[model samples]
Target: MSLANKPNRKLIATLAALLFAGSAAAFNLDSNVPITVNADNARLDDGKGIATYTGDVVMTQGETELTADRVVLYRDETGLQRIEASGQPAHYRQAATEGQGKTDAKALNITYSAPESLLTFEKEAVIEQNGNLFRGDIIHYDSVQRVVTAEGAANDNNGSGRVEMVIQPRSRQNTQDPDGSSQGQ
Candidate 1:
């Protein structure tokens, strides 16, 4: 069946929401935009309520985009249940709110679960937002609770197994002084 069919409209909408819901304050209008997917192949199984897309699958909604080697959608009678994407390194990017830069994430695998409202990034997961960066073996974001947790490699005997984070210092801008001159000059 065609993914653009009426029956699959809800599925596309749910997928858009799942992909962009990484941040609680994500661009509000992103979900309203139509989701577009381009892939070398797509297969839908109505019996199993699953859809799979492979070979350089790229999905986009508004300014948010996700690219992967393979993408799978799982649905139930209730609606969309989960989405999984795998690649050499699946990538996700979304335009952040005004003033903040974009948010970019990449991992060997990315998964979203609707029931838990969670997003998981595994295997060399890295997330960068507004000049701040986080890297770990596994990263989990709870959309509903707006919490993020990460874990380092489990089998690493070296100290390099620890997660890493980098936060950039804010730049100071010129401010008016009491005497009407620039204070930061």
Candidate 2:
């Protein structure tokens, strides 16, 4: 699937898994992940259902893994949210394993609004897709929209990454996408 395409089925269904399964990886249909984490300290806020894990944290969820000094999670009114994340140089991956594909990022500071699925990384942000990478001062991603945005100038250095800021159309907006369900195969 093209990350730049605004296909509807890919986005809304992310919520289906999170609401039913205990793990996000379990909820994802196209991906399966087995991840582990090592945190020096951890805390959870009861009323808000927010958790803060810190100290050389290494967490893996399916094919996605992140290593940072800290990771904060919470549930906003809309859905799961990442409060904040910071480390010496936090590393993250999506669709990364031995052979499948790789989308990785590194940042000094990371902030996310979970409900809106907005992730913003600052201070030397670098993201990779396949063997290529994009580097910038800041990078932001919206999961619901499946859009990745970068600021302060960056390049698709390896020629493997796409430089366009994708604007994914939601299902409600994609009356033009042809799934072929209406026609015989």
Candidate 3:
């Protein structure tokens, strides 16, 4: 089934699994649902592909959501980039993405690189992939591109300035061996 319909608590489980499959070993993260964004006065620059949301701004992607006083997102010749978020009680959330088809995750500050497909969660970053969840000061996720490296970052809680993330496992051994490890046919 498509990630949007994985029947998991973490809506992003399917998408995260599909996106992070190749980098599962490198990241070793859990399934972090999605996030939602809310902004008071939002200004969109379609030509530049930039969206500036200010005044009690809130952004949610997959299971992770963030609430800040102001948020500025801009894209230029370089690529998609985001500025820092400011707020008293910056909020975040995450959820499961797979495993037993259940998900529950959350996050706070989220910085992402659109072109590179890299995202980072810091300051009270929490993650829930499959049936497991972990909370840290920071979480980072890099989405590898066919020609570019995944250079991105983010933050969830109210930590100093760290990043973190959760990922889903999509790889499987060809067969189970007698030694306990999987053996390929």
Please, what is the whole-model Cα lDDT of each candidate in the order they appear?
A: 0.70, 0.56, 0.46
Model 3 misplacement above 4 A: 1-38, 43-50, 56-69, 77-79, 83-108, 144-185
Give one digit per residue, the lDDT tens place, for model 3 in 46-114: 897777788888676554455677676775766445544645535433322322222232345656555
Q: List the lowest-lDDT window of 10 residues for candidate 1.
A: 172-181
Minimal lDDT window, size 10, model 2 = 18-27
lDDT of 1 by residue, 1-185 (tens): 67666554454344333333335432222256666779999999989999999999998778778899999988898877788999999997766443354668999999878788788999999987644677889988766665666678975665478777665443411132332222443
How does candidate 2 score on lDDT?
Answer: 0.56
TM-score of each: 0.73, 0.57, 0.42
Local lDDT at 15 for model 2: 28
For residue 78, model 3's alpha carbon misses the true position, in angstroms, by 7.0
- Best to worst by lDDT, what's the order? 1, 2, 3
User: Positional deviation of 124 in candidate 2, in angstroms?
Assistant: 0.6
**lDDT value, candidate 3, whole model:** 0.46
Q: Least lDDT summed over 10 consecutive residues: which range in candidate 3?
A: 146-155
| Residue 167, candidate 1: C-alpha displacement in angstroms | 1.2
Model 2 residue runs over 4 Å out of place are 1-37, 76-79, 96-100, 153-185
Local accuracy of candidate 2 as per-residue lDDT tens digits, 1-185: 66665554344244222211221221132334433667999987868878889999877666557789998866566545455778888887665222323456789987766446666778678765433344557777665555555555434464333332222223322232232111221
